[model samples]
Target: MPAASTGRRIRIRMSARAIDEPHRVASQLELLFDLTFVVAIAAVTAQFAHDSAEGHGLAGLVPFLQVFFAIWWAWMNFTWFASAYDTDDVVYRLLTMVQMGGVLVLAAGVPAAADHSDYRAVTFGYLIMRIGLVAQWLRAGADDAASRRTALRYAAGITFVQAGWVLRLVVSETGALPPSAQVPFFAALYVLELAVPRWAERTRPTNWHPHHIAERYGLFTIILLGESVLATSRGVEGVLGAAGAGSPLVVIAVSGLVLLFALWWLYFLAPAGDGLSDRRHRSYLWGYGHYGIFAALAALGAGLEVAVEQTGHDIDASPLAICYAVAIPVGVFLMLVWMVNASLLAKPVMRPAVILGCVTVILLLPLAAPQLGVAAVVAAIAASCVLLVILTIAPWTRRLQDGCPKP
Candidate 1:
């Protein structure tokens, strides 16, 4: 059954929609669907904090990236596919629900998956998600002959990779492959998975709405930003627990809030939806570039959690390590956001000199960690945020005054 409205009629059917300018917006169902992913991202970031606290350091980052990539990729696949072919009929809703089930299962496995030695539970959930995607692809292929080739290509790629996941699980369980094999296995799978969409679209590209896809990415970015806020709140709570609401704790808390809001402001300064709607050719770069953005944002949260632990003296990880944990992700987020905005607008959104300068300051933070106090380090990070806002806000303000969109 089509989802109902008391005063509004709904038309839901498995029909091949035209590729022309479709007035697209993220639907309520899409937002509801994103909630599952929000849970998944939170779990992953929490696992990162736990693993980092356990002395995993940079060693744990590889496995964290592997799992995070899988989770992000799954969400991306479903979101883009829905952008093109979402009917919102009973079948479509049911298929989406099945994907949500897989997301929940995958999220449940995140902590254990961080171990890098465990494959059973994570593989199971990944297979479930891919199987659901395969079903969706087949449905789209059958429903839309114009896009049948692209849809079937997606189905074939998903099925093949899912088989590989199952094989790895079976091999590890049977002791035919050692637990150490997951690293290489995961790398190969990531490469293969990324190539599939590019290859599929070469011949028969699906006419997904550019603005809708851009908005979906923006919304997911907001979800990750919420995780950052959650991490910041946790940091404040830890500070309050250990040192009460002292001046230092208050300063740290305020710094975290400033950094969060600055990062949010920086991201929204680019008119991503308008730009993407204009230059469809850059969609691949804009889409692929966000993997780093999403991962960096999530890791930024995990890094803050580590900072909190350090501030509370809960872990003996070096001040340098703590600062690097937070700083590196922030730098990566800044770089990728710049690159994505540049691609979208076909011009630099910020002066290269200014971007290079702020990024260098962020990158140099961990080095200053050895001499600086924890509060000073956090404050420095917040200072960099202030600089970013100062540098980027002017162009946006000028554009607005000129009645032009900020790029």
Candidate 2:
């Protein structure tokens, strides 16, 4: 029941989407699905920012990682699965909507998750999403002969890991698993969840479209970058509310936007579509590597919020710590994006020395906060990002002027 064209009418029966489908852009339904995740990511980032603002930045990392893993994993799983087998039927659309509702449920649990280490609501919401995805997999197994075993494996693996998650929640709630002990438990289940797709696709890989995959990732990247925009707007609001337009917070906000824009610019430079199309076997690593990338971008938003709050005397964190909060994520985002892009492309767009040098500069910039003030330091960090963009882009521009095509 595979469809040759992506824009075909909705089908009553389930089907596989063509692997080489031309111009196979993401559908409106998929965009709607992403909105729920925006809510979920915002909730998690806000909770983390609140913690960081209260000077609990390090201690807050645990719950942040846990909740963000659930959010990112659920989104990734559906994305790849839909790439392979989006039936676009009424039932399929409805099931996807159910996952959206689950994201809201998960979003509603962020505070309890971060403040109290309670995950009952979080687990319940994950269960809802897991149910929707599992049903999709079961249908895939029944309807698509070529990928039936793979689909069944995915369904079974997801079910097994999800049940483990529920059980972990139960034991934790019952005091059998203490808060201190929950980390290892969560780590164990997380490993299993990450392993599911690898184990499932061992024999029969799904016919996912490479260009479509790239486009989907680009859309999600924009969505994550929007967090930084929203976070910066909050900073701007605080500055205007407290010290009016002349406040130094305005500089921080402007610098933060520049830094985010540079990152977005850097991410799109790699020709991911061609690379993934040629090296499909490496898709697992390319996809898995993004965990760090996405996490860093979202964390950068929280760090930016923390930066703004610190300037306004709202957060109790040390000036240096707040500076590092911004610097560290910028460095990580730079390094991980470079690394992930290297794995995807034959030759990375940016040189290794340039990447290392920029990261080193970004990370060390925070140490000067006491002397130059946090605003100046953040502005310098943003300038470094702009420098990196220049370093990576100037060569392409020169090549184009020399009558050579830019890669």
Candidate 3:
């Protein structure tokens, strides 16, 4: 019915979706749009793995964060805008496809950005995406009187920031900036990018459906997790081809699979949909916090790949550094999840003791690598994750010996 109706609805002018509309959900076009990100994420993960395998993991950290911010922010900006004003018309679809093309452009530039610190291609790709988005905002402003001011505000802010992004390259090329100022320049633009939506929504928040937004974020999480599974497979295969099936890589492979599964299970347990429905005003914190969550998950995929490489002696990185690669991202992910839930959930999603304990144990597990070896430590990390799942399970079934958990 929606497929048929979208064609009919094409004739109607764009307008804000009703906040109380029943059965609001992601459209087919949205799913297709999300599929493009798989390539973007896979490119970023592969580049990170390359950097780590070459023993540049520490130095690669800054570029990794910078490149990932581009990917996450692009996807999120489109998501919220669509939640409020998706028309699914001919022009709308074409503009979205244009943004999808920009994602590919950005994905193609990840290597140059990471390896050489050259961001020309990345900046150009981001410019393409923002141009398409600006057009969308313009259309929304012209067609929907209720949201016109906010839409125009979004359009102007995005345009101005994109100009800054383009100019950042020219300024860097002239060698006018001190070496220490590079990151701060980037960070200033980041603050402006984050501030755009906040400034726009102060007058009247767009009519985004809470459930729809939650579903979109959940889908993106699955995409990242799926990418990790693929990265782990590639690493395990490399080890297998070289060392045969008898290698400890088999143990690492199995443990990684379990770790991915357990993390996936834990992510969906947050009840984000209900909470967002109840506390709409806290949306920015809950929404923006996922940047850390998504970035950590993407980096974890790269880390898992490096862990396999280190285990197989294919990489020159220290064993402890390799282990920390996996452990650090895992810890960050755990902490972010807990913090996001604490901010949004009506009831505490999990006992903090369980989360903090698992994080402490997970981080320290790598210290045992000297005695237990990398495979054993990886398995221990996976086991600790499973333990977290077990403790948090059936929380409603009964109170624990620890007494009632914090709200």
Candidate 4:
């Protein structure tokens, strides 16, 4: 009886061990968090749509950039923190729930906040979310020295940046200075925000999980992809309902879908996660480089939404909007591809391809604008994807043949 009892205890211990370290989030949890971001993406998309529909032009672009940057920065910070110290403890779970609530609050205020004469409430809600993020970092710092150092550095940098953001909000709202003067001031502060972290990381580094970080980034990409699909669906449904023309809408939707799929394929085809996983310690560039990619992904979705709205309408869309949809994603995709290759191949063979791709796409734009409309521009985007696939696979295939490890 004593021996049997001891064996039962051992089994229970093993089961507890298994339960403690989850390699990935459960499907339900992923779905839940994803749903919250769905709300966020929808909110941002609505703001963009509203501005475009009103033909606000450059007036809308500035505020969209501001709000988009804030939202993206918040999401990026949370994802990195979770990647590092996601204990999956009950406390951690509860905190995440609070953060999610904060995201929803922030999302709800996005439109009003974008054009608000008094930006204090908007800044305050953002500040609250940042506080929650800072709390998470503080907790991590207290528990693990390495994580603590990283978290503290991150928290400090974020605090400094948020302070600047809040100050800008106050200045803008108070009418103490003209709005034009605020641009350069804000630009300088933005540069500082971008640079300070790089400096800090170089001077005082922290240990971050490579595979987990890679997966977290991949998850965010999936989130943006979800947004793209949503945008495409919204466009298709509206067109079919209004015009009752299924064929054109279907072609447009398929083009968007295919472009997204190709982007996904191109991203995974080169073994980015595995490359980063191998060199997780030296992955700061790979990690930081992804911010551009994330922005591009979100912008792509926004642009697609714009395209959908303008479809079959005689109203001429701005060159800026059309170029933005095609250009931003291509630029981001190229940069991401370059960064991944630099990380894995440990050299810069992808630069020429990126430059060539960019130049080609830019030259194609005017020709495409008059001749192609949204669908043709999308087709142009598809062509760019094809070029990228060729660029990516060519060298990778050569490397394999030369007896190099598959990157």
Task: Give the root-mean-square deviation of each candidate in angstroms.
Answer: 2.8, 2.0, 2.5, 5.9
> Candidate 1 — worst ten consecutive residues by lDDT sum?
1-10
The residue-by-residue lDDT of candidate 4 on 1-407, one tens digit each, is: 12244322322111111112336443344346556766876777667655665566456666666666666666766765665455555455566677677678777777785566345655676787788787776776676654455557867887898898878877777787696786687677767766655655664454445555666667777887888788767765776677765554555567777778877876666455556656655466776677677666766776676676666554456644664555566666666666655776555555565656654674466455655555666666766776666766787789889999654
lDDT of 4 at 231: 73
lDDT of 1 by residue, 220-302 (tens): 98999899889867867876788666655566667777887888888887768778778878888988899999999999898
lDDT of each: 0.80, 0.88, 0.88, 0.64
Each candidate's TM vs. the true structure? 0.92, 0.96, 0.95, 0.80
Clashes in candidate 3: how many? 0
lDDT of 1: 0.80
Q: Worst lDDT window (10 residues) for model 2?
A: 1-10
Per-residue lDDT for 198-293 in model 3, tens only? 999887789998989999999999999999998998887887777766557778888888999989988987768778889998899999999999
- Summarize candidate 2's per-residue lDDT along 369-406 as a digit string, tens digits: 98988889889999999999999999999999999987
Q: Which pairs clash (backbone N, Cα, C closer than 3 Å) in model 4?
A: 141-148
